[model samples]
Target chain A: MEILKKLKILADSAKYDVSCSSSGSKRTNQPGGLGNSASSGICHTWTADGRCISLLKILQSNNCVYNCSYCVNRVSNDLPRATLTPDELCELTINFYRRNYIEGLFLSTAIYSSPDHTMEMLLQTVKKLREEHNFHGYIHLKAIPGADNLLIEAAGKYVDRMSVNIELPSERGLRLLAPQKKREAIIKPMTFLTSNIAARKAERRKSRKAPSFVPAGQTTQLIVGATPDPDLQILKLSENMYKRFGLKRVYYSAYVPVSHHPHLPDISSPPLLREHRIYQADWLLRFYGFQADELLNEKNPNFTEDYDPKTDWALRNLDYFPVEINRADYEKLLRVPGIGVKSARKILTARRMHSLDFDDLKRIGITMKRAQYFITCKGKYSGQTAMEEHLLRPRLTLSPPKTAGPEQPSLFSFSSDVIAPEDAFSSVTGEI
Target chain B: MLDFVYDGSFNGLLTAIYEIYYRRQVPQQLLSSPGQTPKLFVREERIITDETKAGKVYEAIDTKISSRSLRHIYYAYLSEHMEAGIWIYHYLHLGWKLGNKLDLLLSDERVHRIHRLSQKVSMERHRLLGLLRFQLLRGNIYYAALEPDHNVVELLAPHFAARMAGQNWVIHDVSRDLAAVFNRKEWVATDFTLQHRLELLKEEEYYQQLWQEYYNSMAISSRINPRLQKRCMPQRYWKHLVELS
Candidate 1:
């Protein structure tokens, strides 16, 4: 087949993977090298789906041996299959990089023939990009499950970031949908990569020139809504993964239906809003000092679609509200419904010079519409007359004001405006 | 009321600030050349840009404030806001008195305005670094043109220099008629006019087609959101973008 035809099939197959970050590793171009990875990732462009295309996300081959029900590349799908030669992949990456189309390559492969063979092909492509092409740009490689420990380790040294996708949340879901992939097959490589990365860090501390091992860190993805796994169970598993294996991110891809299976949810599209809420709760877990249990529990298995996870948490624990803005510490300031990490930091830095009032808070980038009920400035409250949940809940749940007209251009707006806090969290966590 | 006017340059702005301090007079406004209409009792003074005076003020600021704050000042200057000259003056005034604590003085209107202005310019510069596209032209020179809201050509040049070290490239700010030309080893800024139209390399069209194809194939059709795409990459940037065009 022609290279472009293969590219279309392979890239289309890989679109569902959804991890597009090319960040957290600061590798500068060597004397004769062609590219470099920035510490903060750059989004080259936004696709029509409103997703950032940061990397050339493509699969080496879309011909799989395993029958994962949720996947498009599963063995029984009967879609057009295509694989690129290692040389073809390298040429595409270099050409795209030269044209400023992408930051680097996000190379994944299906279980073509066997796991070891697929991984070896991936390793050869990445190694060739780094060594022969002198490409020093960001490369995110997949740590193929059930691949040999030595193969995973050797590949880790060449790439900036690596991930082993835990496709389903629970072991039962894995068995029901993807019977070939055992829980151990996924977790074992993650554990091996984590320990090897730790050892490499220790080695680098002793010697400045020691080669890095997965410097951007490992991330994983879980297909939500495919099986009957509740939000609480999924989040708990994610929390445990973060603690145990030191994963940088856990992406939740709302299960987009591809195959007509009696066992799977009979939905045409993924439950994006649910995926978005999980991401919001995930952010609270990572940065906002909230535990998985705090966000959702056994009683409340799913987050409400009406309000964001943070707002929901704040409303439930009203005793924590009426926080004194002037005297509250950074942690307390962060718990407010409307305030984000950036706004919270702004408040911290600004409060040192002078006490902040409601007007001052607006100027400092706080979302006053939601933050008003939760905060007090200089012992004064500017919230509604009644602080009851019934009254405040309706106010917090109101949609954002609409733009003047559809064609009225917003010159200064950014990607943050496109994705709300929860949506931003979902996209960033998925990509990063 | 005195209106201090200077050449429209960062050094000129700094010199005006120095004059404000030296003369011990608070000006009604600081105007970049092409001063506004003068009132009966208002004095308009044309202050020439002096590198020595600008250097002295910058050195003092570097000593008193953090280098990060200095960058903020530079970026704020690039914003070219109507009141940026006055805002920077007020920021430096506080920086001198409070030293490094001026960054935390966000409640102060002047300091907050400058901080926000700096952020706007810096964010644009950062965004353009990724959004900027280059078309390979004849003579092996890659050329790109953008009309950013702020003056960020100089800010973006060093980044491309390091990333595309061995290549020849030119980033043209069509709005300001300024171009940053990077030869194989080094780069310099030059005043450019669109006198001649250059043809793209034959292979450029083929690669652009492939990129557009890849871009279209990658998006999930079920989740198409043009509103969000517009917000992330504004329509203003779409003219030069290969895939969008």
Candidate 2:
């Protein structure tokens, strides 16, 4: 294909990947380098959706040998196919980077010809940019599942971060939606990279000269709502990845219908609200400190559609409430509904100097509407106690209707109130 | 009742604080204006710019609270909130009472509110460093203008020179008409104007094209959340956004 035509085709194909965040990497421009990576997130561009676009996210090739049923670029799809030569791709990225159009590149592809061929082309493009063009900016390379270990290792050496998307949650789900890709193909590379990363980290601990391998670490994406796996199953897989594979993040892309399939539901679009809720739950896993089994099970595999994960947890475990604000441990303080990481940290830091009363807790910015039932500041409870053990649905429904806006429901409204008490507690504790 | 009115400048504000502290006459209201008439029962004070008084005020605040806290107070002033003056007064009072231990008052919503406003101001200033787009004018002076929510015009002075040190640049806050000028060697704040027929249209058009191209390339049509977009980059500021224009 001609260079310009090839560029458009590859760029359009690569646009589907949403995990283009250019954060968690800090690289200064080398002596002959052309770019810099900020520690904090930088906006290279703002999309119409108001999302920050930092990287020139594109695929090297959309020509796949494997047929992933959900993927539009899968081998079976009769789509126009194109692939950019390593030099052609490198030139495009460097020109864009130099012109201040993009911060770096997010290079991914379908299994073009074979995993090795696709991976080799990706490594060539990135290595050429680093060695020839001297481009030192952020590069997030998508490590192809079942690719040769050497290619994956080569990608790690040049790119700031690498991610191999798990695509589906369970091995069963993988078989149903994308038959060619097993759990092992994705997991094996993740396993290898994790060990490689650990070994590199160990070397760094001993000496300062150990070169960084994927300084931003590894992240994976899980397609939500495609299969029968519940949020619990998804979170379990995510938890295992975090604990065992040491994956930095497990992105949940709400399964947007790309192609018609017998096994998949004939829906207009993936449930975005469900996707958003899963993200919140995922945040609970990573930062808020929640566990998977604590959140869902075979009986209740999905999130409570009515309440947030934390609020649901809080309601389920109501006996834990009325923990004295002045004496509760940091973990206990974090469990109070409406109390966030910031407020919890503030409470922990403040109680060092003075005894906290109900007024003090309010002053510290606790949303008493939700936290009151769960906490007692110096043994003072300012919240309604009767609703403490009530299921979130009825209690949240009881808010006075004296004031209501057209767009925004009352803060306690199920649709509007995101950080439900139980959900909040679960996320905060990393409990299931 | 004593009322002290000062020019809307940090130095002038500091001078007023100095007079209040030195004179030991507590005011009924500390407004930031020059010519407003005080009530018949009130004592009025006109605040003129005095570097010595400003220094003394800075020193007193630094000794009482902390240099960092004083900087936050200045940041709070730049926040342009209607209650900024009151927040400053409360901040000063709180500083005197708690000293450096005031950060521990994180649970106090009032203190937290002021700190949040101060943080907002700082965040805006940092954002402008990345967002500010300069256009080369007729006089070889690279000019970028903004109507920032915060008083970021002053905050940008230290950065422009380091990045674009070779060229003369003028970053103007069009709403405030205050500009940060770097003359290749030294940088200072000035009230600069378009003295010549310098066409901003060509530069504006170039930026418009580039921004639109980037915007078009980046958006995932499936994930178009205009409401969320509007919440982040408000429609009020769309006139200045090259992409939207």
TM-score for each candidate, following the candidate numbering:
0.94, 0.84
Tens digit of lDDT per residue, candidate 1, span A359-379? 888877677878888889999
Compose the digit string of candidate 2's lDDT tens values, residues A1-45: 666556656666776676767788877665535677766756544
Q: Name the candidate that leads on TM-score.
A: 1
On residues B179-242, what C-alpha lDDT tens digit does candidate 1 reach at each position? 9999979999999877798797778887887888889899887667777677778888887788
- Candidate by candidate, in order, the iRMS in Å equals 2.9, 5.7
